[model samples]
Target: MRTVARVIAELLVTFGLVLALLVAHLKWGTDDYTRRAQRGLSDELDKVWSAQSVVAVKPGRAHAVTPPAPAPAKGRPFAVLRVPRFGASWHFTAVEGVTDADLAKGPGHYPGTAQPGQVGNAVFSGHRTTYLAPFNRMGELVPGDEILVDTATLTHVYRVTGHRIVLPTDLSVLAPVPGRPGERARRASLTLTTCHPKYSAAYRLVVFAELSASRPRTT
Candidate 1:
């Protein structure tokens, strides 16, 4: 009996140690790696900004003219995203694709979705528990909170409408009019997504916002 108990105890201890290591990697190790990746992406975004121009307009003074931009290459950084509710210093470069390799660097724009400021749903997905956890505090956001998307030509300012927890299989949120598939959209919308409840992909927690106003890129 003593030998059997000792063996079981040893196995349990080993399992616990492995779990701790995995948690540590998910919580801290990945953040360091993502921060370095973000720096590289930011450099690329700077180049895009230098090469592009927008007809400058003061915020809330004139309507923003959102001319379509060419589709960005996969894994390339195309925009800068900021949520003041996350933190004044919080930002992540918005990359072109939502592939694993692309999101490891920053929040990724869903391909085939509307680009920022376009009159359709522009979706972005990011990790909630690993790789900098860019959308970690998404639940704290309420209606009226701002989501800023800065592209080479304009800064789209989105206001939060609401949020929902949906099954991973839910595709309605990807509609041009979110949650209303098959409808034509006439206004720009934003959708941000991440795995729900943290450390699990069983469900998705999505935040919906609308383009309240936009301004020409000044910086």
Candidate 2:
């Protein structure tokens, strides 16, 4: 009896140690990823600004115009985002045609969607758990909170209008081409989605926001 009780206590101690290690790893890993993401975002933003040009509109006003040719789709549409309600802000990084390692560092886009301010829906994705979950609090977005997308040409701001909870099979919710048979065609918008119900992927949490305004970035 004594031997059996001692073995059980040892097992419990081992489990506790493992749990502590996991907690520490998650905390430290999140911080490290956050710093790495910030640096990458900043560098990308600088590159975008340097490559873009603005067209003069009026006194103290200028509008971004597409360069005679596109900016080489190598980076991303937006430069930075400001989400005050959720306390989330970061420069947009292009994960298109990049590895999962690149995507894990920051928000990534679903290829083939409209880039920011392109007169169509732009869909972006990020993880709900692990490696600095930037969209973890995405469900808390309120109407009128700013969602900025900075491209080489312009910086666009979006005002979150609504959100929805849908099943995993609801791919129609992401139609960038628009003109669905039954659903109303939403205007130029942004949709953010993640695994719903917390800690699970059974459903999706989606937030929708509409383009509010756009301005040129003054370098």
Candidate 3:
């Protein structure tokens, strides 16, 4: 009886240590790696923008600028996203691909989707409760909130239009017109996607926005 009691106590202690380590990894280790990746991506974007002599427009001013002739290559850092509602310093580098590795770094742009400021849907996906929780507060966004996408040559501003919760297999939410498959795109739009219900991946939470204004980025 004494030996059995000691074994049980040891097992419980082992389990407790394992659980604590898992929580620490999720809380600190993942966030630290993600922050390092985000900082590296931001510096890469700065280098890309610095090579060009772009024009600048005053805030709230809408200007016409041509989108990049060709889309960025897969896994490349193309733009930075800023959500005013998140906070003044809250921003993330948006990479070109939406693969697991790409998203592990930060919010990633969906492949084949329209580029920012283009005449189609620009889709971005991020982790909701892990890897720095880039979109952890995505549900807090409401209509009229501003989302800014800064590229090498221009800054595209979009206003939140609506949001929806859909199944993981619902590809329509990623359509050119969002939720409308087979429809051609007529205007520039932005879509932010993240896992639903905070920590689960059983569903997707999508936030839709449309281009409100765009400005040139001054060199």
Candidate 4:
């Protein structure tokens, strides 16, 4: 009986070690595949130059900024964002947060931030290296990407200006225009966000882009 008890104890210990390893792998091992998928999407966006992605803007019933409205046909509402020189483009759904669950379906839109083509700052969030990392190559994006926000009603275009890495505590990057608040709303901007420090969240990656043009939907 004592020998059987000892064997059971050893088996339990082995199971515990295996469980721990599985958890760690889930947290980090999938990054390589995720990065490849992300880079592939960026490459495809670089090739496409003239696709009509439409973005429609309306008062959000929810208090969150840029809350996603349903697509006209009940499918996912996708918007095309173009950055020409950077060779970056992706279809993002305006859901909130960048969690694993949120990213599995699409890029999560930062809540309480302005929607694209709105009077304030529109912030979008995505994972950098896992869970279908749409923004993994975010650091590669350069100035002059034609950021196109498309909805069911219209398409809005913006140009990348610059980027900054700020502490998570420093959320001023989400503020309208990053410093000016009293000026009359004249333009729209896109702020893309992700975890900074490459593989960690020691800081926040922020990409700032400004509106350049707009096209109304004909349909």
- The TM-scores of all predictions, comma-separated, are 0.89, 0.77, 0.90, 0.61
lDDT of each: 0.90, 0.68, 0.89, 0.64
Query: Superposing every Cα of model 4 onto the true structure, what RMSD results?
Result: 10.3
TM-score between model 2 and native? 0.77
All candidates: CA RMSD in angstroms? 4.8, 4.3, 4.7, 10.3
Residue 11 displacement (Å), model 3? 1.3
Backbone clashes for every candidate come to 0, 2, 0, 11
Identify the runs in model 3 with alpha carbons over 4 angstroms from their true place. Answer: 54-70
Q: Select the stronger candidate by lDDT from 2 and 3.
A: 3
Which stretches of candidate 2 lie above 4 Å from their native place? 54-78, 87-94, 97-99, 177-186
The residue-level lDDT of candidate 2 at 37 comes to 72
> Per-residue lDDT tens digits of candidate 4, residues 74-100?
112334444455454344444445456
Return the lDDT, model 2, position 64.
Answer: 56
lDDT of 1 by residue, 1-219 (tens): 999999999999999999999989987898999999999889978876665545558876754454556679898999899998877798889899999988888899999999999999999999998999998899899999999998887789999999999999998999999999999999999999999988799999999999999897776
Q: Judge candidate 2 at residue 187 and give its lDDT.
A: 63
Q: Model 2, 1-219: lDDT tens per residue?
A: 999999999999999999999977776777587567767667876765666555558788777555642533433433455576655444345444223555566676666666677677777776666556667788878888788876665678889888889887887667863324245445678877777876678998888888999887444
